[model samples]
Target: MPKDARNQSPELDPVIHPINRLRICATLYSAGATDDRQMKYSTLAELTGLPADTLSKQLKHLEGCGYISRAREYGSTRAKDTVWVTLTEAGAQAYVQHVEALKAMTEGL
Candidate 1:
């Protein structure tokens, strides 16, 4: 292995290693790639194909760790409320590092 590759053996981030969370991070990362860093909760739900409760649980965990931010947007009616989610700077950095680790592990394969 190259020295740079050898030095890139970053530990996998526990928070992002789970499939659900990894998907979430990947979605958010792609969104940011298009200059749209935030996404609606409904959009994330649709992308992940996860039930509401399960998605909520995962969001809460990511938010608790300061990896993501959640905000509520309310319209004139109670039915118009929406939740918005965005990946935080820290979260992006962590996810990128995790990906680098994955790449390093697969380099020789």
Candidate 2:
């Protein structure tokens, strides 16, 4: 666990601390354990049980933080477009560090 220099407390990543964001990161991490980590936007939405709009907002925020990236394949219709989501290398590292911090904080309990 990386700690603050002054207080020596484990640091939690604010971007990944939200419940929904945490779930999204965990889902992406689990998918990454497989051969291919890239997941379709709709598939991610289904797995997370999050509405499309909500998922889109969360993904946007993660992308802004360089935690995730999205690629879009245009189809005939906007609804038919396929958006692929993947966790970036930086994102994977941040998620792992965040989880470790969480574990360290809870280990005493």
Top candidate on lDDT is 2
- Model 2 lDDT, full chain set: 0.85
Predictions in order: lDDT? 0.85, 0.85
Error of 1 at 102 (Å): 0.9
In model 1, the worst 10-residue window by lDDT is 29-38
Worst 10 residues of 2 by lDDT: 1-10
After superposition, the stretches of candidate 1 with alpha carbons farther than 4 Å from their true spots are: 1-8, 33-36
Deviation in angstroms for 39 in model 1? 0.4
Q: Where is model 2 more than 4 Å wrong at Cα? A: 1-7, 33-36
Residue 79, candidate 2: alpha-carbon lDDT: 84
TM-scores, each model vs. reference: 0.85, 0.86
> What is the RMSD, in Å, between candidate 1 and the native fold over all Cα?
3.0
